[model samples]
Target: MVRIDDLQVFIRAADNGSLSAAARQLDLSPAVASAALKRLEAAVGAQLLARSTRSLRLTVAGERYLEHARAALDALQSGSVALAQDRQALSGSLSLSMPSDLGRNLLRPWLDAFLQQHPGLSLQLQISDRVADLYRQPVDVALRYGVPEDSALVALPLAPDNRRVLCASPDYLARHGAPAAPQDLRRHSCLRFILGAAVHERWSFLRNGERQVVTVDGRWHSDDGEIVRNWALAGLGIAYKSRLDVLADLRAGRLQPLLEGYDTEQTPLYLVTPHRLMLSPAAVALRAHLQQCLDAYLAGPRAGEGRNDSCD
Candidate 1:
């Protein structure tokens, strides 16, 4: 008979693309993991994996069985949770992916507090600017800043009012006078942010119900948003950045908003998951916790009172 542990081992092996890696993750010996897979294949009466010395590939039968196996496991987990008398104590591991800037500057404290609240829970965080593949990567959820382009994923909004703001330090503005309008940014030193191979030099704004795109240039650019913010803080150049990223600086008078009359396009934040039903109890709890924290922060009294823009 195929055991639940065997199914779990098979699923982990499929996800990692290596039996040894799966065994390591599950704290099982390689021989035991191999035997589990063999027993699972025999019970199912089909060859699940095509194994070689160097690699392993899922057979057609394995590919079809994998989805069902995952669904069954999820259902079992949900049912177990439903039957449990103590639902407040959540115990499990959650893996998350997020941008480097938000992960370090914003979410780090929030996550630390969350971990403190749940002693039984553990977390694995992957910080990178690149968007992670939910289906292929070893992440349960991703906190992203824009609308998801993938139709297969489910996106839950965390912050709808989040937007990019054109900002510069007081010293920089004093030295080179803030741009009076979006078009005037062409002559100013605008720090550019690069993602992958693309340079995000085109800054967009909306004024009087009309949209405009201004192509700006700068002497320095970096792929990391945090670096760009640091440059802006040092009075290097103007930067078009997310308000959440520069909120504290703006409030403290280190950075001042530019193009105040013109509103930038909204880039709402989202908590993305692979599937709603596939979400573990730990993931669900974290999602709610994040939403509450973000909402409270955005709705606080200091949220909208920090702009020192003279243009508006």
Candidate 2:
């Protein structure tokens, strides 16, 4: 049987990226921490961690073993909570990662409310448009779009989101005349998102239950959603983007949805984390809070609802 204390030390060391830092947090000396790691590795009969003067890295076996180890630890902690459910109070750290556009618009307010409710917990929020790898990052939870391919993590559906709409300002439409059909877009200027540019530069449309992919060329491309959005606002070109993200602008007459009939599939947004049987108090709290906010937002009226020139 693995000693819980030893496993805890190993996890803490891995998380902190240093044995000394783990020792400091656990209130143990570096020597004691080092010895604990050695014992833990010996009991497992595999080299779990690679040690060097400059860096600590997980061996291939270590990487595989770490997943099970974390799950086991979580189960144990959760069991204790279940046993003491009547008297337990949540107090721990929660690290989260999210895509920038969603992070700014959807998650910010929920986070604010979560912090107010759980004053004792600590949170670290990392925002980036680039997909974050949960294995490489030490976050407890993440809010992400698109389905995750990692089998080691568990993804929970938080909200329904999908195919971004192609949109532009009315001034742009008046100046460049609206393309009545997807085929007409080939001649129009487009603003493209950089993440999947090679694959998504050509926009997609659906017709009579049939799918058609259009390879669109544009004078401008960016990885930043906000930047591409701003370009659309300036009447530069048509931009494909999330409905929620563009709803406000569409309502205010700053932007117009170019084609509404083509979007057939919607992508689901998710709350994800490394798979574990039991989640900590902070993680649980945040997940619940996010779902609550999502439900409320979806039920409300669309942002910027009453624009003068409409493209619904």
Candidate 3:
């Protein structure tokens, strides 16, 4: 196969009318330029240059090939530039699956901003709390809170530092009072989530290296995480949720975080792709943007949105 570098060498040598001078212009050694010219001629099965001891010039075949070679190089350069531009620009459809709570509540603003930035792009978002089946679903990408269970799927960590936040509405806390400790949760109405067949009534927290598992009961329970968040917001019961899901609510003092001193179980968010994303430029850009939002959530509560860090 004739290399692009060899083609450049041939063109330069022909244009300059000196093999050694072409080497100087291309910043190549004289030997390398000579070898490239020989390789190009051999690949084409035609002697493109007629060189003697004193003078060098193109043969009859060389004059005919020069224009064609120049066009081939031009075409390649144009194709390369177009490919680069396509990669840089975001367009076309972005099919995504996201959790009900995070999708509907937390990411609405982020999605809005993204859409505004790319007018040519469109979104197909499936909002649900149930884990999306990449194989069965029409989703290109999925934003999930937990560590990816499927080893086959490619998981991109958006926020690896993300952890669950135990919280309740100020109204709910004002009514039922807050739990003083993890043990006290047993006495409180803890809103739970039911994933498939398993009930998540057992809330776990780490206090001073000791793990506490409190199995509390509540009247409100659902498979949908958003439902659990709504129930918590309506002052139904204490809900353990992702900080990113309830960041806006927390900022507005609608939900008050509990057990700040104690560590809640990690629920690192991941962007799962079925086959290494089959990802486009838009998908890659969106992932980066979403991660920034998640990072901001992990940065802790903002100023003036402060709550009493004291656990009671």
Model 2 regions more than 4 Å off: 2-74, 80-89, 196-199, 302-312
Residues 84-197 of candidate 3 have per-residue lDDT tens digits of: 557666668988998888887667767877888788889999998888877556688999888787764668898888788899999988888988889899878888988767
Worst 10 residues of 1 by lDDT: 303-312
Candidate 1 runs further than 4 Å off: 1-88, 301-312
How accurate locally is residue 250 in candidate 3, as Cα lDDT from 0 to 100? 80
Supply candidate 1's per-residue lDDT for 20.
90
- The residue-by-residue lDDT of candidate 1 on 270-310, one tens digit each, is 99986654466777778888877776666544535543221
Q: Of the candidates numbered 2 and 3, which has the greater lDDT value?
A: 3
- Candidate 1's displacement at residue 104, Å, is 0.9
lDDT of 3: 0.81
- The whole-model C-alpha lDDT of candidate 1 against the native structure comes to 0.84
TM-score of each: 0.73, 0.72, 0.67
Can you write out model 2's per-residue Cα lDDT over 1-312, one digit (the tens) per residue? 579888878877776678887787678999999999999999999988899988887888888888778878888988765665456666767788887776776567678777777687778988877777665566777887777777556788887565577788998998999878887889999888877435357677887888877788889987777778889999998888876567668666789887678763465788887555326666766777777766656664555443212211
